[model samples]
Target: MSRNVILYIAMSMDGYIARKNGDVDWLEGDGSEPDADIGYDEFYGSIDTVIMGRKTYDQILTFGEYPYKGTRGYVYTSEKRDNNEDVEFTDENVEDLIGKLKKEDGKDIWLIGGAGVIDEFIKKNLIDEYFISVIPCVLGGGIALFKDNNPEIKLKLLKTEAVNGIAMLHYAKR
Candidate 1:
């Protein structure tokens, strides 16, 4: 089976993934349903690998416990540092790495966030699908989901749903 790269992330209504200071505290909702994960569990189950940028990896580390313990995780970074046994750090060319992964035998890959990594993958047209959850708030200034120099790409809406004030959008490359 061919592997695919899916960009699954959440961003504010104004397109910011996090505040200017890299704070994502605004992702939290106010007194919302306890099970506000939307379709995260299902989406997580569909992927066998997760790739994210250094900053995103650092943020996940602050969560106390590793959230992606069961999956193969990779952090794209050039800095030399120690990481969890379950995670691998690489400064390899993103396109080449992703191409190799896509040819290997495994489930789809999940492209986790932090604008730099996402922008790199987007520039190469490596993402096959997008599962974006648009939160109900707007951040006036911050890192955007798509950076300023991104190439224009079109997507076909596969599905869309609203739950607990979040709009979940699923799209496929057109």
Candidate 2:
């Protein structure tokens, strides 16, 4: 059996997932630097599949000319989308999605997100762990990942890494 349902996201210090208008240049360091965070690379390599909301998938599409390698990624959405080798779009709710995923023989299932998707999984008690990268900057106003958290949640710290003024906090649900 495979371990399941992990969420991976990089958030600004003030808890915003992106800037007010959805810009993230600040987290990228200077204009010409490459995102060479080894920890994140290693983590992504471990996952066999990726699942994300339609908006997040679209946002990823807007960046980079090449394809996302290794894993097959699924976009969670109700509307039909053009099928591609890299992406599979589905509108199934999280529970149904997870149930269907559990039947597939795979390694870690990654929830690449919009805050709403992550919040929905957490609220449904379906998320297994949270791998959060805390970028060292604050966005006064923007999209937040925990905006609808109704219950206080606790995390068991698994490890920490400091790179590019970012704190990679690995927390498992307690």
Candidate 3:
């Protein structure tokens, strides 16, 4: 079977993934204890590869150790960079890269994002599944999850759930 490209991300109720400055400190739940699972472990296990934009990769580096250990990572960037044990940086076209990966024998791919990569994938209609977790707060203005001027793509809702005050919505291409 073809590997699906899933956009698994959390966004504010106002549709912002992070603050304008790229701070994600607002992704907390209740603050009563440590962060809840929110199905992350389950979802992470279902994917064997992760794709992200250059900025997103840089941002993730600030978080200390890489979170995706076993999964292969691909970082889209124009500049030349050395590959590491965890991820390979490539300047390949979005459509071409995704097409090749889909044909490979592996589990679903995670389209983890920054706005640029997400916008490209959405425009190409390459994403197969979307797992969006809506956080409780609203960042009046920030990095938007969806950019303007993109073609309207329809989706079929697969499931919905609430965990730790966050709304999780699963949808697939229609």
Best by lDDT: 3
- Minimal lDDT window, size 10, model 2: 29-38
State the TM-score for model 3.
Answer: 0.95
State TM-scores per candidate: 0.94, 0.86, 0.95
The runs of at least 3 residues in candidate 3 whose Cα sits more than 4 Å from the true structure, single-residue gaps closed, are: 31-36
31: Cα error in model 2, Å: 12
Please report, as a residue range, the 10-residue window in candidate 1 with the lowest summed lDDT: 28-37
Better of 1 and 2 by TM-score: 1
lDDT of 2 by residue, 30-145 (tens): 22325655376687777888888887777787897525666877788778788788888877777987888889888888888887777788888887788888877777888887
- lDDT against the true structure, per candidate, is 0.88, 0.77, 0.91
Tens-place lDDT per residue, model 3, 86-150, is: 99999899889988987789999999999889999999999999999998898999999999888
In candidate 3, position 9 carries an lDDT of 95
Candidate 1, residue 59: how far the Cα is off, in Å: 0.8
TM-score of 1: 0.94
How should the candidates be ordered by lDDT, best one leading?
Answer: 3, 1, 2
lDDT of 1 by residue, 15-116 (tens): 999998899998854346656668888988899999999999989889888888989989999899776777889888998898789888999999998799
The prediction achieving the highest TM-score against the true structure is 3
